[model samples]
Target: MQGFSGRFKDLVRRLGVTLFGIFELLGLPRVPEKKDGEGRGKG
Candidate 1:
């Protein structure tokens, strides 16, 4: 039904936002395996 689909879409959007925020907080923008001589130092 239309209502069910709408709810599902909203739920998925919320979950994506939450996961993205968690990643952002956990240093998602920084590369983990990069070394000092490359560019960015290790976190």
Candidate 2:
């Protein structure tokens, strides 16, 4: 059986990383831009 602490920690870390990638793909408001403000590119 796996140790509880290690398994739990890994799960939390994986979850955090997964959530970050998901939000990045979603392009949420809180994410920072390389420029000073929002992108004004042609859509």
**lDDT winner:** 1
- For model 2, residues 1-43, the per-residue Cα lDDT tens digits are 7799989999999999999899888886574657765667687
lDDT of 1: 0.87
Position 3, candidate 2: lDDT: 100
Q: Which ten residues in a row have the lowest lDDT in candidate 1?
A: 32-41
lDDT value, residue 19 of candidate 2: 96
TM-score of 1: 0.61
- What candidate 1 gets wrong by more than 4 Å, as runs, is 32-43
Q: TM-scores of all models?
A: 0.61, 0.59
lDDT of each: 0.87, 0.84
